[model samples]
Target: MGYVVPVRANISSINFHWQSLVRRPMPYEISFRWNDPEAMDEPRANVSYVGYVPRVESVFSVLFPCTGRVSAVVSVDIMLNITTYQPKQAIIFLKLKRSKTCLQGQPTPLNEAANDTVRLVLGGAEQDLSLVLGVTGAIGVTFVTLGGVMMFYVRQRKAALRYTALLSCWSLEPEQRPQPCDLLGWMQDLSASFDRLI
Candidate 1:
């Protein structure tokens, strides 16, 4: 028999299986109990099958249904009832342990025996970073470009203000005021002298 329950977000499902090593057909019933007392209402199933080979064993697998996110470690107690030639029934308990990461499609073996638990790992949803990176890069480039334009504009305004102040100072001396053409020629001479000195 088998039991099914909701698994955590990281885990997609759990694959549980058992094998009968006995030579004859064995009637078995399996039940599951969770560590959490609140999850007492777990699903269980029964099976009746026989073992034909001595060393070889038949494997029976079941998937545990996953529902919501599980943050803590979940411990499951497996109880098995095997009916043999004797009138009395034999009970066996196998402990299955699961963590949040184990459910992410990674196959985890519970026991060393070949008939023990084998988990199947499921891949989580992939996140797209291309769009986010593109947008961020675009914003950064725009900000840098805007800062450069503003700096250029401020430098141009400062230079124009300095030139205006120099012109006003020259105009204040009415007796020494130079003609517009002479002023242009004087500015060119001053620039040529500065360049030669440099």
Candidate 2:
């Protein structure tokens, strides 16, 4: 018969102790596995040992690999299998214990380098944006300059036309004076030009 044991601890190392009930040596097999939910197809850690037990008790320890320290309580399972010549032929005893290790400190060099790379990329993007804004500002200024020049040329042309109309009306001979309609048209043109200039 076998039994399942539930263990809860902040574990870093697992120690296993077992002994045979009989006074003589015996052959045994022990397996240890760590199950991870993220990887259902395969366990994260698997260890197996097959050897003969001496008359005295046997003790062994397995250190689980960890990238960093874990503070939270975790659950794990321990399984031990034994073979004997006959059923219930040998007495057996198993003991399991957990030990904790502390690893807390500042950021590692690799992490610092990664953070610096991210900052550099963001800085480069900001500089590129500034350059684009500078170009856009220059284009806007050029457009404003062209608009002012166009307005100046248009005003000058209108002023010249107004002066020429006034001179033509003055130089006409008394008998060659414009009809009432022609005079009215010239007056309307001069009034519009003055309005636009003001």
Candidate 3:
């Protein structure tokens, strides 16, 4: 039973054992009680890490030739989000009951239905705000420094090209040199590129 539903939380991986008992119509009530339940609100349905027990439904749906009860020890992996603010452990309570209704349309519990509890120990929060902030600041500084160095290198390259072009024009005979209009246009284009870099 490795199946699990996705949840929204900074949850580290966790592995635990769970059991399922099916007497009649299978339905169960599951509740998680934090050691300090008063501090936290009840988990909403959307964020609750709830999942179905795999293969239990299909196996239990069949009618048997002889009457008997079925029980199984299931391995379930549930991802629960723990925080620095919460307790280190929790108790999971389960109540197995019948989902079938009576003649009066009221649901009833099975006589042999049982309850179970599993102790879950959660590791402490592995990171804090300072670690995150430190990493972020280091990355920011690295990018800024790299950008500055790149800009300086580009400026140097452009200056070298400008100087080489001017020296080439000076070395050429006056009549062979570029037309003033062409030189002006080229200067304007270089200025435009410089402006873009700025």
Candidate 4:
């Protein structure tokens, strides 16, 4: 997640709070880089917490030049880096405030600012794997049931067609009728075909 500041507004300071929810003590770090598409390359901003620490609440008062034009909106990219092996979660709160001089020779206060919070989770792959397997098994069972129903429908259609053909043949005149032995042989052949299909 990222935050956008107003164009041409001076970014005087950025404050952040980092907390870890791991039972055992572990080292962690946070840093951010500026991503400007118009520039040749993104430049990294220096914050206070480069070294590894368990938890930190830091503020950076470095001057950030607003390169955005009057009518265009520019964004800054902030990235956080955490180093830990065990399953853990962290809550980060960030605030960006600016101060400037007004037309009446007055210094505006830092009343208006951009604020954001983020929650990071790490290492929960086992639960995800179980969920995926459950969904896959359900899909497999659905497809197998659908296939059985389709096969049953096809068999019924074939039997109906054979019966219809027999009835049409029997409707013919007596001189053109099929013999009883011939009808019996045809029925036997149809049964054998159905057995083979099944």
- Runs of candidate 4 with Cα error greater than 4 angstroms are 1-122, 189-198
Where model 1 places Cα greater than 4 Å from the true spot, the runs are 1-11, 14-18, 36-56, 85-198
107: Cα error in model 4, Å: 54
lDDT of each: 0.45, 0.46, 0.38, 0.48
Using TM-score as the measure, the top candidate is 4
Question: How do the predictions measure up, each by TM-score?
Answer: 0.31, 0.35, 0.33, 0.36
Across 118-186, the per-residue lDDT of candidate 3 in tens digits comes to 333222223334556879999999999999999898888788777787788879999988788799887
Q: Stretches of candidate 2 above 4 Å error?
A: 1-123, 179-182, 187-198
Residue-by-residue lDDT tens digits, candidate 1, 41-120: 24233233232211233344433332223333455555544454322444343334442222323333323222224542
How high is the lDDT of residue 122 in model 2?
A: 8
- TM-score (C-alpha, index-matched) for candidate 1: 0.31
Listed per model in order, the count of residue pairs whose N, CA or C atoms clash below 3 Å is 7, 0, 0, 0
Which pairs of residues clash in candidate 2, taking residues 3 or more apart in a chain or in different chains? none
User: Against the true structure, candidate 2 has what lDDT?
Assistant: 0.46
